[model samples]
Target: MFNSFLKLTSICFALLLLPISIMAQELPSSSLYVVTSCYVNEGSSFLDAVEEARATIPNDDNAANMMFFRQPIAGTNFEKNQFFRVVSWNNLQHWAQPRSLPATQEYSCDNHNRTFHTTRVVGTNGNTAYTDTDVAFVSARQCMAKDGVSLSEVYDWVDTRISRGQASRQNDNTMVQMSHKILGASPNVASGRMITIRRIGDSRQGYARFFDEQFMGTRDRTLGALPDAPFEFCTDANLTESYIVHSPGRGI
Candidate 1:
């Protein structure tokens, strides 16, 4: 009788831990992102800034991907001529490799840098493939998990909604990314919070269609409905015009 009880207890414990082990294996590997916010110098146009960035920035084997996001001045906290530069690595090990930047005086901008651990929640863009002409309309916002809610729980909730086909109006070209601040963020944003970025389309027309679908067509009330979502996202979303600067397989 004693031996049977011991076996039963051990089996129950193993069963309880089984789901956790499976979830761990299913979790996607995260990438590291180095994001820089900058303001172009007075009298310098965006074209000049882009040219300077293309010439100076590292697009070597270590860097996984790079992008430039043009921030709109109206209805945004950003100053005039403000933009963002984002560089990503496959993992922390790759990012730790010694990479040097060549000296260049052509790039003129006041910049602040931050690092993040970014994970993909939906879509297939893993930040790997891109073309020079590919343009994306991006919407980013800060979010905080609710009390007793874990990050994995939030990911599971999003995954469930996505599986149900209620996540977004965009097609397969869309990508939803969640980024946790590893180096920098405002004091208002707590450490438990994360930044969510949604890339709507490959072009401006795709973004327009998204809005039209939201207002004109049937609304997706189930995407982030309360009682279903484990976290809450901020209402103030920053929209930007994103352009691919460098990608691995694509020629610069």
Candidate 2:
């Protein structure tokens, strides 16, 4: 795997001023997040992972939140502890299996790797109905502070286009192309596979392949995108399909 961390926590970085419009969708006083958990050697049980999380999170932040993955964050009923979610690796069970268990499942001493990743945003109801694109920005000048003439200059050019309302121009697939170009150059920040977009109580997520020096095959790191919840690695469902229908839209 590409040096992927199992579980990561957010550091308290001061907020850079964002547009008030976008800021409005940000989670309340609490910092919003996109958490990803994965089990590499042998997938871990949902309950066990949840037990692991219980030891990691503070008590207050565990109240009234949402999680999504192979299914909704509920065990038949949405009741107490709507605040947390636990998803197993049953996500791609139908697609990944032929008709029987994989021969590998017989192997014991399997190591399960779980990851939690998130970004803070304002005001979404933590539902699937909301959608938006998230971008990480840096100044053409600042990005070159040491490396010199970084590709970030391209964003300023794109922003100029958007300011002129050309963000919709088909000939220019601004974001997608930029992702490829940047990864081609930096090759490191590109290690992250899940790109998440958050708004208020909800968010949209998608997984992409990232390069790793250690894997023989392309590691399929996509644990599907989720609303303010955990990413699901195996599932036949893509819930945001219903939510982001009317577009001419984009999000990270």
Candidate 3:
């Protein structure tokens, strides 16, 4: 009986390694992110669920190279708090097919789900690699220009801001990556949506300091000059902040 148990463990370990070893070397022009938001059950501890997921999620493997986060901001969606799971993959072709679940993640949550894909617009690395303990603060903006704004004008605005920031920084510490939303689940329009990622420290206070310095600092010093909002194409928008709960491995 012990021998059979050992065999099962070995097989599972090997299976986990297979995807990592076989992962593609090059990244695609775009990636898909499936964002799931849910509330923890009344009796279940969210932290406990995080601990179990850390043990079970095979983030080092192809399937594990995704991110999980918690959206602590309140007063939205009728004040129900939620967590998020972001799954990223280069190839859309194989995403729907059955894949083996990690032996470690033994948990679940409840809520509404939304998904979107982004096309790389500007950055040193268009993909994300998350850390286990460090909580990254992410700010995503979904926007559209008003009547007279052309798509190219909005594109130039973001592209120039990123380039200017990169040029001003003496080091890459203030680095920020931005992407344009290409496809999304309803109310998540594609035209002017932008997602910005910053590696703030592990705590909420730390994130606050970093956020201030990055966005509220002296004009064009940390992050480049803020671009004027183009209200010509469309006027609707949504912006939210979330904390990283899980880190993703390097993007292929």
TM-score top scorer: 1
Best by lDDT: 1
Off-target runs (Cα >4 Å) in candidate 3 are 1-28, 58-64, 100-112, 119-133, 145-156, 169-175, 179-184, 188-210, 214-252
Error of 1 at 60 (Å): 3.3
- lDDT by residue (tens digit), candidate 3, 150-225: 4455545555666665555443332233444544544644444444333323344444554566567675642322
Candidate 2 stretches with Cα past 4 Å from truth are 1-30, 37-61, 70-112, 121-252
lDDT of 3 at 223: 33
How do the residues 60-178 of candidate 1 rate in per-residue lDDT, one tens digit apiece? 66765555645552246676677777766776787678887665343444344455556565544443222235566767666676666666666766656544542444543445666
Which regions in candidate 1 have their CA more than 4 angstroms from the true location? 4-25, 73-75, 102-112, 124-132, 163-172, 218-225
lDDT of 2 by residue, 189-229 (tens): 33343232221111222211101111235434334333322
TM-scores of the candidates are 0.77, 0.21, 0.57
Candidates 2 and 3, the one with greater lDDT: 3
Residue 180, model 3, lDDT: 44
lDDT of 1 at 182: 65
Please provide the root mean square deviation of candidate 3 (C-alpha atoms, Å).
18.1
The 10-residue segment of model 3 with minimum total lDDT is: 231-240
Instruction: Provide the lDDT at 180 for model 1.
Output: 62
